[model samples]
Target: MVDQLRPNPAYIEAVLADAALSPYRTWMGLGITELECDRALVVLDIEDHHLQLRGTVAGGVMASLIDTATFWSAFVRAPADAGVANVDLRVNYLEAVPKGARRLIAEGRCLRPGRRLSYAEAYVRDERGHVVAHGMSSVLTLAGKGLAIDLPKYLEENE
Candidate 1:
């Protein structure tokens, strides 16, 4: 049986439908291909807006991927009643994504999990499987903060 307390990877469409994630889902074409208690896989389809003046993927876009990946990795392990915040984020751009690259995939791993804080790292790769960026972040669970959707309800409904 799946653990209802944990984020459900199977119902990605339902999870992404939450209003809080609308920007990432609609604007950035971000999708969660995999999600677990301590890891996540996020993908972004390459588009014209993702490119910079040089025609390479913009650094901000890469950073956003890292941020989203790390955040989700940690969030999956956080308390169900709390909301997570990325307190610190650090990313290193390793390569420029070629214009022809179809998509970027980010793999995130939670290094440590705690009631109040969590640490996560993410690596972004181009469609060709070349590492383009690496990042790490610290996430904090804030009391009295709740997500826009009732996660437990969604999970139960979907299940």
Candidate 2:
């Protein structure tokens, strides 16, 4: 099991709902049904027209979802004053996305976190149990001013 540390779901849900991040998702609809400190599970339900001409999820979209899912596992657990950013992210695709796919799941976990950097990893797959992609991510913890100061009331403090 992952450690107790985790980001509040309400905060994460709000971020996922942010329209600015839409262009970066497989579904053009970023979403997270589950979230926590060391682990997170996000889903992307893209439409057929949203796909590229080749009928696959755009590479940039895939990369963005991968980066976001992995980073959440680190940042959600960060101190309220943390400043975490992804330093480097490497993703590997093992299968192509189906044209009529319903959604993609990005399951991520934080391997370790410290004063400077946090290591994270995730598996991207469809409902069919196929291991479509995977990745390793590196998140840099900036100085104390990491988190948004005026957090919304829905986002609870990490106990």
Candidate 3:
């Protein structure tokens, strides 16, 4: 069995707290409360911006939640020097989130890990624990085409 490196807790914490690291996450007001080898838990506090003209949570918001959650779940299994990109994502919106819903939690789990591909599934739930959306995604891992930013060096410098 190949040994897998667990993501550092400090790094995850810093990533979540620093807006500069992920502008999209900051803009969406999303937080990652749990990140492990094969699972990730993300949360979003519903705001007016998240609602549509109908006063319910927009479909795009749920899509984004599933996308983010699945990415994190499969990312952990990727090689350190590899870049993972979602090649395919399928989402099913089950229930509408009312305007007054306070929060939404998205949980993602990696279903399969591979050298060049990974599969993940995610679910978005309302504060009442009703699943609002379900999603599945496949990520392609690219070797020698890692992220442009040097995350470790940046983290060290920031610390």
Give me the candidate number with maximum lDDT.
3
- Ordered from best to worst TM-score, the candidate numbers read 1, 3, 2
* TM-scores of all predicted structures: 0.84, 0.76, 0.84
RMSD of 2: 4.3
Q: Model 1: per-residue lDDT, tens digit, 39-156?
A: 8899999999988888999999988899889988887655555668899999999988886888999999989988899999999999889999999999998876756666677657
Q: What's the TM for model 1?
A: 0.84
Local lDDT at 151 for model 1: 62
Tens-digit per-residue lDDT, 31-75, candidate 3: 888878889899999998998998999999999999988988887
Model 2 scores a TM of 0.76
List candidate 1 stretches off by more than 4 Å: 1-14, 19-21, 151-159
Q: After superposition, how far is residue 116 of candidate 1 from its true place, in Å?
A: 0.6
Residue 47's C-alpha lDDT in candidate 1? 91
What would the per-residue lDDT of candidate 2 be over residues 87-156, giving only the tens digit for each residue?
Answer: 8999998888887888888888989976678899988888797878889899887767544444535434
